[model samples]
Target chain A: MITTIIIYTLLAGCLIASWVMSREKTIKASKMALKVLVKTMPSLLAVLGLVGLTLGILSPQTISSLIGTEAGPLGTIIAAVLGAITLIPSLVAFPLAGSLLRAGASVMTISAFVTTLVMVGVVTAPMEIAYLGRRFTLLRNLLSFAAAFLIALLMGVIL
Target chain B: MKTIKRYLPIIIIGLAFIALAIWDPEKADASLTVSRDYLKEMILIIPPVFLLMGLLEVWIPKDKIRSWLGAGSGVKGALISVLLGTLPTGPLYIAFPMAASLLGKGAKVSNMILFLGAWAALKIPQLVVEMKFLGPEFTAVRFTLTLIVLVIIGQIMERAFTGRHEVLWEQPGESVGQKTKQMGTKR
Candidate 1:
């Protein structure tokens, strides 16, 4: 919330400064902003809705049990799915994952959780596609999904 | 038809929510709450970010981007990408537009991947929190692994997905179109 305020203030200051420097450029710039907003609106709403549904269905308790039930590849896959689908902030995610780790979850499971949580963003795909187009967004997510899985296995072994 | 197709994702999700409400109101309520909260954050943050990206397109020279992050940039470009990504910028989604603009301005696909990877998996503040909660060893291990894998992934993507791209916010009079912007291939 504070971040939002600071960003808005910074944005306002920058807009003002730009307007003072070049009214034409500022207008041109904001015109593009409007275009982008219009182009990306449906995707943005979809992201929000998907995030809500995923998080609602997979409560923290449910997530813990799914990731904690098994110590093998299955658990890691479950964790990865949970991470990819849900957009948990690092602040909340770290503590929850850490507690799960202490509560007998395998290092691989937690690694998969943390890695996919950051690397793969299924819920945010709509927004990604809006900006980056379908090909780049799909490739990035698929590749990151593979990388996250591999990294989890390595972390499980080494740590 | 195109309009409905564009809105299909949200429409499907909306139906899912309605079904959940009918079958189990409690779960539906929880989902709506989470969605509402996230919507608030998105609405608050997106405007400024988009405005900044617009300003960036106007202010930053295309050649500068080409030289700094293009194919010829090599190792230095990766370093710069990581540095740019690690800063406490906004969420991962915000980076998507910025990355696209940079790519349009001739950023290497590999470097952009590094940038996105660093932004997503390795933000500085997020690392601090990870170290505090998960201990230094765990943090150190994961960070190193993530960075290494990201570099590898970036290199692979650089090779695999090289082609023309659609530049959305081109100059004012120009409509959106595919730009055959092969970064540094001419050189």
Candidate 2:
């Protein structure tokens, strides 16, 4: 698939760049990369496990029906708002969105969910505040959330 | 105990999600499978993107980039930040960490807001996907409306908050250098 090819190509490019950027010996750079891999592994595994469990339980049809009905537009808005409030990881959000798409969910709904999944983060607030001051984090997320809702609404109206 | 108290809300939220997953184990399982596929896809796409980001971090001079992006007092900086964000090819997760780094360096609140807004509202890949699933007209309208909303929302944010915090422009290494220069002058 095109997506598969793109992913492989990006991975190859990343590896090459990592190789080229090493000022230290190749071995040291490789070791550092390995360290990063190790550090991220546990979290990655937990995410994988959660994702696997979620897929085993929820049917795409159910999610689609929920977001794609006469009441679907309202449902879509609420979902988008909720998605913004909840900080689901990108790894988890995409497949869920993809499944909803496959199950005949409206493009509007999926788009809204994906946008909010990334843009608004009620959960990451403290971390965001600590990193980028309180005013910046709060205002940016508020704006992002509003933008996401507008994007979804327009998509529904036009599409 | 102190650390737990600080993170209590996050902990509670996580528990609630887990509880939801448990309450309907079968539904959770299906969702998890889809989520796994998504994760794999993300893994495939993210590394190279991160590499390019790292390259940008190394190459782009923070202050130079910041001056143009700083305080959304004017339209030019806001528009530039939004455009810059629209062009990037990755998910929001990747953008956040990098944006945080930029904020540490001298990137203004408006620029950061623009980046986050545009990144979320207008991704090219997602647009193409939308076109395929919906149609061209729909995608165009959504894109236009989203852009307008982001700008308006950004302006509102700029007006509402005025407290200038020290963390807004805390670049690493520069302060140490400044301190050293001051000490030298004093001596």
Candidate 3:
């Protein structure tokens, strides 16, 4: 909600400022915006569909059931993979991780889930690649996937 | 057709929905609902973001952008990137275009990497939720560790992928809202 407001505010401010400075430039900017939007639309739609399917298939109940049964390095790996692939909002995901933890998920498992849930975005990769290029998108997500596991293991050691 | 190739993913997703519908109507319905909600959110946010990026490209001078976020902007630039990123902005998809624009405007790859990283993983609201559910200790540790890892990853990426060499920013005529040197020099 706040994010929506902030984005609108920023957009309005920038639009007004650009218009006041130069109407021609403002018009040109709007055209640029349109062009970029059109270019990105296909990938954006793909990402949205993928997100829907992944979240639908891996409902929270199913995830909890799947993640809670295991309790070792393999469990952590599963948790990381789940996190990497799924795009759960933090409001739901953090609490879900908490419950999973309380219900006997290892610290490493929950940590892997939380870290990868934020860092590695398999679902959003199409949109990311559209803007950031395939090489950059691939490298960032791949590195983030590795980083999530490392962070999870270190968290397991520390806490 | 070229257009068909471009829309391949969407087409594949459509087929998948059809398969899901046949295999499990309930799951298909749920998926459609989720996709609808997401499409609504995207519709609400994406246009304004693109417009804002457009305006930013037009109004913000390349020199000013370089001074603040360029390769030489150093630690201060990196700190600013994190600060800008951690704002209660929309999702990471929103950040991708903005980060790309910044890169085109001569922002350091390292800083943009941090910007995207922070946008994704370390927003304040997200951290609060993490602390609430994951415990203060767990949140703090992950936060600090993630920050350190982001810096390292940013540096590694900057070294491995020379920012200017990347083809992402090679669109002709306009470079982040400003005309290129050839046109400017000719003018």
Candidate 4:
């Protein structure tokens, strides 16, 4: 909700500014936007499809069951892997993490899940690479993945 | 063959959908529903985001961007990068183009790295959700640790990628040489 409002507000502001400055530039910008959209369409569509398939097959119940039953260190690893690959919205993911925590999932496991869920983007890598280049995407994601584990470990100790 | 190579991922996804439909219709329907929801969200967000990017690309001069967020901007530049990043926005994928834009305009790799990291992990709304679900203790600890990690990661990546910026798929309207020059590519 806030995201929508902020984005639309920024877009409207920029569009109006561009229009007032020069109609030609505004038009060119619009065309550039369209070209980028088209260029990235394949990867976008691919990511959407993959996210749907993953979420559809691995229902929340299934995820909880898998995470809830496993032991600590191994469970945290699985959670991290699942979080890295999956693209659950934070709204949905947080409550799920809370529940998992209450249901005996370790702080470490839930932290790993939440951290990687936000930081890493195995599913969105194609779109990321398309926009930011392969090496940038690879380094960012790999480093974030490593950082997520460190965060999880520290969180496990502290809280 | 070129077209095939380009769309191969989409094609594979299509085949996967077909396979799911044949093997388990209910699962396929569920997947389609999720995809529909995602598509709707993307449709609402992507156009405006891209347009805003377009405007940024056109209206914001490279020098202006460099002065504000570039290599010499230092600590203040990094703060601005985080501020720009933490705006309530769409997914992490949306940040990639913006980050690329910043890069093309001479933003420090470290600042851009910070931008991407903050955008991914430290948005205000996301933090609230984290606090709500995980408690202040967990949230605060992770937030602090993540910030430290991001700064360290940023510095390392900046040093590693110091002069190697030649990559395919040029931004619209900029010549390859111009881009190479702006990014300080050795070649």
Candidate whose DockQ is highest? 1
Q: Against the true structure, what is each candidate's TM-score?
A: 0.95, 0.62, 0.94, 0.95
Q: For candidate 4, give the DockQ.
A: 0.72
Report i-RMS for every model: 1.2, 6.7, 1.3, 1.7
Which portions of model 3 show Cα errors greater than 4 Å?
A: B163-187
Alpha-carbon shift of residue A52 in model 4 (angstroms):
0.7
Among all candidates shown, the one with the greatest TM-score: 1
DockQ of 1: 0.77
Which of the two, 2 or 4, has more TM-score?
4
Candidate 3 lDDT, A1-159, residue by residue in tens: 787898898888877877888999999888888988998899999999999999888888888988999889989998999999999988899999999988989899999998888999999999988987888889998999999989998999999
Judged by whole-model lDDT over C-alpha atoms, candidate 1 comes out at: 0.87
lDDT of 4 by residue, A41-129 (tens): 98999889988999888778778888899967899999988888888888899889999998889989998988888989988998888
Query: What residue pairs are clashing in model 1?
Result: none
DockQ of each: 0.77, 0.30, 0.76, 0.72
Candidate 2 lDDT, tens digit per residue, B19-69? 767797666655556666757765775454444444444445756665676
Cα-based lDDT for every prediction:
0.87, 0.58, 0.86, 0.85
Which candidate, 1 or 2, has the higher lDDT? 1
* Model 4: residues with Cα > 4 Å off, grouped in runs: B166-173, B185-187
**lDDT tens digits by residue: candidate 1, A1-159:** 666777788888989988999999999999988888998899999999999998888888788878777777788898988898888888889999999999988888899899999999999999889888888888889998998889988998899
- Model 1, position B92: C-alpha lDDT score: 94
lDDT of 2 by residue, A1-159 (tens): 464476467656755665687644334434433443443343344444444443343334444455655346776786676566544544445566666667677767777876676667664565455445577777777767767767877676666
Q: B1-187 in candidate 4: lDDT tens per residue?
A: 9888989999999999999999999999999999999998889888988888788877888889888987789899999988988875578878888887678767888998889888999988888998998888888888899889999999989997886663333557678677677567431
